[model samples]
Target: MKIYEITFSPTGGTKKVADSLSNELGRDITGVDLSDNNEDLHEFSLKNEDIAIIAVPSYSGRVPATAAERISRIQGNGAKAIIVCVYGNRAYEDTLVELQDIVQKNGFLVVAAVAAIAEHSIAHKYAKDRPDKDDNRLLKEFAAKINEKLKKKDFSTPEIPGNRPYRKAGNAGIVPKPTKACTQCGLCASRCPVGAIDKNNPAKVNRKACISCMRCVSVCPHQARKINGLLLAIVNMMLKKACSIRKECELYI
Candidate 1:
């Protein structure tokens, strides 16, 4: 059976967790990056025999709207799906359940769910260097168990947690802008998930369209993209208490 690693990870932390899970889940695992802004988001359909491990980082406790919108376009065609929601150490409140709902609506059979933690995308100090050795061991164990479940023909939908009307997603939190050091190389513009950065002049940013996923900040080769230092300091203070404590990955089958 083919395993599809479908994820929307902007800053790479969530992708790392999804990669570890996919690597152990099976051989011939294919990747479908939900972050690719240039792709035609709606072109794939999975066979019933296929398994899709759909993962997305929690954006303010919900699936990022861009991710949810792009992901909704793919037709699952009754494929078995192991839905995963990766979040910073803070919290994933409704992300996993919300994502499972989406894949199911797209015709996937929900077999299992995982809520995992990675480093904070915006404020890197939290859950730093995650999906480390111990995290990989746990992820592999989860993969093994999921494999065992797949062996059985039964495909009952698993119960996932969340409310019918998810909590409101917060406003764009940390929009990054290119610094004077920016060379208008367009890498950040090309890579912005929502096309928030101006293509011709890479330093120009449209904050209204920005999701603040930090792709520009993380992808900049010259480290020219950045958030306001004062804002970052405030965010650090706001999240410090919620992020300092270690959190473990949770699985629901």
Candidate 2:
């Protein structure tokens, strides 16, 4: 069966986890990158014979609003899906459940769910070097289990973590800005999904449209983009208290 790897990763943490899991599956995987700056969304038409691994990062215990909207456009066509939610060290909360509902609504039957931990995008201090060696091993083991289950034709749904009503959505975190090193090349502006930045000037950012996903910062070749120092410090302190050091990855099928 063809394997589709769909992901929305801004800072690369979620992409790392998704790639590792796809590699372990030892299949030719088709990737759908949701990080494109353009407004175009993927239009998938999965057959019943295909399998899909859909991965997305948790934004404040919820799916990225833009990413979720894009994913809803996919036509699963009754394909069996494996839903993966990658989160910073804090918590995934209702992300998995919400993702499941979305995927199901898109005509995919979820046969598996994964909650994986990766380095925090904004609060880098928490989960500093994660989806590390241990995380990879766990992912491999999870893939093996999935392979076995598919071989047995088992399609039972597994219990996924998250609350019913979901925790209240949190406020948008810190927004990034171009540093003095920026050349005003307009790359960040052209690559901003929400068109928050002005193409003519990299320094201009419409805060209302910026989602704080750090895409512009991570994509900047000059390393010129950064969030406010004071804001980062405050976020780090809050996350440090909320996230534990010994976080683990989980799989359900």
Candidate 3:
């Protein structure tokens, strides 16, 4: 069966987890990077014979709205999917279920699900370097389980953790601001999925259009972009109870 790895990972954690799982499956994998600068939402397609591994990072216990919109545009072509939601040490509340619904709407049947942990994109001090060695080993075991299921053609649905109504959607449109180190290189603006910044003036961001994905802040080579310090502090304090290092990866099939 053809295996496709479709992922939206600006900070690389989600991608790393997806890659580990895909590699352990011992199948040739096709990467569909949702973060590609020139990605056209309309261009992706799948077939009934294909198996898709859809991965995305959890942003505030939900899928990034921009990535979800882009993913919704693809035709799943009746492919079976393995949905993965990777988050920082914080909870992944509704992300996996939300992603499952989105993928199914695009005509894919989700046969498996995973909620994995990765380094926090913004609060790097929290999870540190994650989907680390321990996580990788768990991912390998998860893959072996998936491979066995596929071999037996077992397609049973597994229980994915999340409340039905889901926690209310969190703040969506907070844009990152450039700090004193910004060189006006326009990288953030150009790479922004929603075109939220003025190309000529990278410092100025249209907050209404930003999805608070922290892509710009994480991708800045000079580390010039930053979220509001007060906001980060508040968020961290509120999330501290859910932020204890839960570092194992698993598969539900």
Better of 1 and 3 by lDDT: 1
Over 4 Å off in model 3, which ranges?
172-174, 245-247
Identify the candidate with maximal TM-score.
Answer: 1
Candidate 3 lDDT (Cα, 0 to 1): 0.84
> For each predicted model, how many residue pairs clash, with residues at least 3 apart or on different chains?
0, 0, 0
lDDT of 2 by residue, 65-182 (tens): 8778888878898898899999988889899998998899999989999999988888777888999999999999998898888889887778887887877776575678887899
Query: On a 0 to 1 TM-score scale, where does candidate 2 land against the true structure?
Result: 0.95
Residue 206 displacement (Å), model 2: 1.9
Off by over 4 Å in 2: none
Summing lDDT over every window of 10 consecutive residues in candidate 2, give the lowest-scoring window. 35-44
- Give per-residue CA lDDT, model 1, range 177-231, as digits (tens): 7778888889898888899888998877787898999999989999998899999
**Best model number under lDDT:** 1
Pairs in steric clash, model 2: none
Q: For model 3, what is the alpha-carbon lDDT of residue 24?
A: 80
Q: Per-model C-alpha lDDT, please?
A: 0.87, 0.85, 0.84
Q: What is the C-alpha RMSD of each candidate to the true structure, in Å?
A: 1.1, 1.4, 1.8
Report clash pairs, candidate 3: none
